[model samples]
Target chain A: MTTNHNRLTIHEAHKLLKSKELSSVELTKATLERIHNLEPKVHAFTTITDELALRQAQKADEFIAAGNSNPLTGIPVLVKDNMCTKGILTTCSSKMLENFVPPYDATVVERLNGRGAVIIGKSNMDEFAMGSSTENSALFTTHNPWELSRVPGGSSGGSAAAVAAGEAIYALGSDTGGSIRQPAGFCSVTGLKPTYGRVSRYGLVAFASSLDQIGPLTQDVTDCALVLNAIAGYDTRDSTSAPQPTPDYTQCLTADIKGLKIGVPKEYFVEGIQPEVAAAIRAAITRLEELGASIEWEVSLAHTPYALAVYYIIAPSEASANLARYDGVKYGFSYSDTKNMWQAMEKTREHGFGAEVKRRIMLGTYALSAGYYDAWYLKAQKVRTLIRREFDQAFTKYDALITPTSPTVPFKIGEKMDDPLQMYLSDVCTIPVNIAGLPAISIPAGFADGLPIGMQIIGKPFAEETILKIAYAFQQATDWHMRKPNI
Target chain B: MKLSREEVLHITRLARLGLTEAEVDRLSEQLSNILEHFEVLQQADTTDVPPTAQSIDLLNVLKGDEVAASLPQSQVLVNAPRREGDFFRVRAVLE
Candidate 1:
């Protein structure tokens, strides 16, 4: 048995488990033990479902014994706390839902369970997926596994960091903005944010319902494709889920990118980018060019600079309406001390939400307010159209767009904590994809200051296969995705 | 775009949040700063563009009105903060 079995990929574990050399129970135990030992240091998981994990592991072993095992059957996976898991304490890293346990699983969770994947636990995230750094979790800060003092770019920090640290073989993260890919870049893992509506959002706690997409973060692009294959499908439960056919994503993992055109948006490579990060992105572009892909420059996303502005307006505007359900009534925490329902709801929100959540709620409320709706909310939506149109225009010429996942490597934990604008800028490169409802993947491009830098490959609407093929080709030529953090 | 204390208070009330004086003061400054960032949207010439309410090319998707079993009352009520006899118990709203 491999001593560091926790570090093995899902594909590697799949082969071992199928051959009867490794049992799912042993794999689950190793993952659990790794999580247990590192919980104090990484603070990756919010809830560890040990009993459920073991039971699921036994079921996986049975499936393997029966020779009915799939590629993901025995794999141990962690999901961001925002994705509901039946009978598990699915807190979105907030005190508001700190005790909220849903009676159902998310559609993604149901799929994972059907595949017999051992769901080890729920990873930590920004409260309600509101912020960039997991420091906004309101419960605890999830430190970067690579450098414990630095942040793992969030709100999917816990999921990305856990995969990087080998606590989980693979994890699921929801990306409204850059929640999945940015953190993956910071941690040197592969994270995929599928096109909106490609995966069912039936049970995901609503952030920005339109932009919020559940995706996979894994050690390599292959695992991302496998996990995507399992989760990408339609359901009547989510009316917005696209009825588009989900191709076998794993089939697109070929290392051939011949005769494909790649785009590099000039607006993405502006000032304030760390020098090393820029150099690595340039080097990765060169490597891709050498591999037979043509690179096109100055593909101007004219509305790029306004993405952060548009996202803040739109995401929070939806969030305000979505979060109004948490007013101390149907479920979750309540401030019962108040005498009236109105006072009670107000007090519940006052005591329950953290600073960042409160700020966004306030921002959303202000934008969607009576007098300013046209100026703020309506304008942002039109600009959002323009943003998407830019991508639509670009995809006609290019198969995919490549950019730095984050402007800089992971910064010190408290560096961007006090400054919300600086924190919001962390998602600038990754935000436009969410706004446009496109699929994008962030793969390890290279290292800077001994930290990993992620390069994003953005695809057109429902073009996850193209980006995955390009990412796979890049991974074949480089060892960045294979570089594990020494946590 | 500068928000007054009264304006902040009104917005907070609209959002159903009871922020403290300290929080309100901090938010007054922070929300103003955030709104200033949003002022850039005015520069985008979206004259011929229609607003994108939904990003996907999705339209009026209607499901059959067939009666499906709703979640059991017990499971639905299980997570309620205050419950009484299968009903969520909230403070008096009519008054």
Candidate 2:
């Protein structure tokens, strides 16, 4: 008895539920059925909660029946597996925590539950959110919904794929360097990576605590706004969270950008971008200009070339420290074959972590070592200040900046897996935003060779409203965000 | 930019990860390539700039000192790979 509820966005479903034309239970059932059918081809979810979703759906029905309907009350959602779900397996798609279930909910999870968002399952990710392609997952690889042979972008590939496949209404993903936006770009969905401290990261599995941020992946800009409204707020648990009042994100979606000043950095449009991807972004820029938003093409983010290098040094350096807790005791996997505890810990890590995770740990350890500290880690941090300053200066003249989310469209699976350096370049365009701790959103620009190309709108620190308004205008004038994959 | 075999082994020791001989050889080449990428930071001329450990400016967030509810002991130890009487059991530290 699945209905036409699978493709409804949060805004569309809200009106239907409020008018007593639909129940949350029906929407949940259809979404669960879609997951059951498409999961074999998409491989999006690591775990599917059928019983819990049904129970939550019934409660959402009750809440709506009592006339307390909010934007998210009946919406079925998916969260990346990195977020701790109480009593659910929260593996980061690594063998290290394959069976580890958390005892508490992440702050984002708690906030969503409070708003009556029905979480259907946890999505797959790169091991410890380390790589650019979902192939880094030790358990399984998530294929793009558009092309079953191609990859969904990493590390939040599963969440992006799920939303693109209509397996969920909206989903949440974490971005360290473009985990959310890159995958959403590849899968042709909308995703936002809020300003560095916009959301609390309390129960999130740490990859690089300083850079990691949690955000939403949705079907449209409207749904993205609703999901952001539910999840963005401050919490005392995370010291890095900025103590600021969150404006209603959905309130800004009504107005269009008429006289908005958008900056286009010349450095981002370099030689590496695929010709088709470049063409689509150019057309999108033209469309924005036609819609009355002025675009400046001479902005220079001079330090763009150093972002990837700095990220590699600093992210892995923080990873080496954040990942130190996975020793063979207290939780997760442990090796007990050896009698000595120290050797056992070593063996457990050797057997538990995947190659990508191990490579990062080793690289980090060497960079922070005695002779290399001043040359690598500390120098990278100083260069990070430079990159941040570039964005800070650009925002003074522009309301928002536009750039391609990734250099190229999504490639086939296993194409870049063998070359780690090539894989590292997948995040080249998106990493600088994380370094600057600014807000950005990726929306579907158009298709390139039948694959999606994403264009990002970046705003100043804590200025999520401006970017969302600009993106909403572009999305209204274009139908790119309406296209769904056939999976 | 090249990581030697001895150096790879030493770094693994510091990281407390035991890699087989084949794993060491492969990681040395890969880690060397990765390090060569980081060498560009030397050209950045960050002579007078300060290091940024965290991006946000807020710090020293202190919660109230009053006692709050903690996780139950049963839930905390539920996922332990090996447990004995509410304590995690691991291989002996000393011989």
Candidate 3:
């Protein structure tokens, strides 16, 4: 088996599988071997499904032998721990649910399994998907594959890091607030946070129900599109899933960018953005312009500064309520016999939750409390409306908005763990898109001082095709996404 | 920004978790640090801005009040750490 450490692009692997050059079992085994060798150092996975993965890979090979080949057939993909997989210990990196084994698969997992995609493992994440850095993860922190000392941004850090390290060809991640994109930027991979409701969220342990979205993190934009096709669609099980027609995302990858209107949001280029990151973003815009896409400076969103505050309030507020179900009575880790129900519940939660998780829950509870509801939660929702409206007006004139995915390059782990406020600002660029519930993608823009940076493409709701098209064009023009970290 | 240990305890109780005194002291500092970041929003003139609740302009998605089959109670409680018959076993709430 070839164990060449260079990352395999999903498209290349698919072609090889089709041509009989490589079997699904071979690929799955290779990836598992890589995980065994690298995972201890990378800390990308919380639980690696070695037995289940090999079993699924054998099944995928049987399908291929029987002449049944699909886009994801025989491909191995990692899933964020938050997405439930039947009989798998799907801990969202929280001690609270450390022993929880879900009885059913998250909608995406079901879809991937049906398509014969081998489930590699569950990636680690910030507990309840709350922090900018994976340092908040309860199980263990996932180090950036490019630089072990730096963080793979979170809360989807594990997914991003795993893909970056070639542990899997592609992976699934959730974005509540830049959880997918920021980590992708940090790990130098392609990750998309589709328009809210583009994919079903059933069985995904809720973080912020309204803001949480599941999308793909892949080596390139094309694989991101393929994964999106496999996972996205309407599901009656998820009430918020849009009943819109799913597009063939691969068809949108045409190199023709003539007359495409790409809007560069000036607000994104404000001070505090590192000079190198700013230069890379500008170069991306220049590359797009050279490819026949018309670039225009636009003032689309002015309420971006409020996105973090509003997100902290609303996400936690919803989380506080949603997490109430895990009070020692449900399917999570529970306490032993105690004097009173209250004491048991208290002990279970206190021992289960990490410091960050507890802090967010408390903040959220306070925001939604009777006296504070009007001032915090309600007010935040109203501000979210304005943020959405700003994008709605912009999409009328522009095909997509482009910006830096993160303000700076990946920072060293534990650098900002003590300063909670500084950590929140790490997702500044990616949060507004989540606030607006729009389709957005992060593609490796360029490198800065040996570290990678990512550029974000935001599109109107249901305009996933347009966003993918822009990212595809940029990926073709630049080889940034192809640069594997020399770990 | 400053948060008293009392304030941290109050919030922790509201969140339905018990905190140790040491945890409370640490959280007071952490919460205060985070709230200081919230100061950025204060400069924004949001007086007339209506708070946006959801990103999509979605109306209530209602389904007919029809019976939908649920998982068997046995299956649901199969993983419960403590269970009694069809109910999840728990410490008694009151005398």
Candidate 1 structure quality by residue, lDDT tens digits, A43-133 = 9999999999999999999999999999999889999999989999999999999998999999999999999999999999999998887
lDDT of 2 by residue, A348-418 (tens): 99999999999999989988999989999999999999998888888888899999999999998989988
Q: Stretches of candidate 1 above 4 Å error?
A: none
Give every collision pair in model 2. Answer: none
- Cα deviation at A188, candidate 2, in Å, is 0.7
Worst 10 residues of 3 chain A by lDDT: A1-10
Q: Return whichever of 1 and 2 wins on DockQ.
A: 1
Question: What do the candidate models score in CA lDDT, each in turn?
Answer: 0.93, 0.91, 0.88
Question: What TM-score goes with each of the models?
Answer: 0.99, 0.98, 0.97
CAPRI class of candidate 2: high
The DockQ for candidate 1, computed on C-alphas, is 0.89
1 or 3, which is superior by DockQ?
1
* Model 3 misplacement above 4 A: A298-300, B39-50, B64-69
Off by over 4 Å in 2: A1-3
- Every model's DockQ: 0.89, 0.83, 0.67
Q: Chain B, TM-score, each prediction?
A: 0.90, 0.93, 0.89
lDDT of 3 by residue, A271-294 (tens): 679999999999999999999999
lDDT of 1 at A336: 82
* Tens digits of lDDT, candidate 3, B1-95: 67788777777777778888888888888777776776565565556777666666668887789999877787788788888889888777775
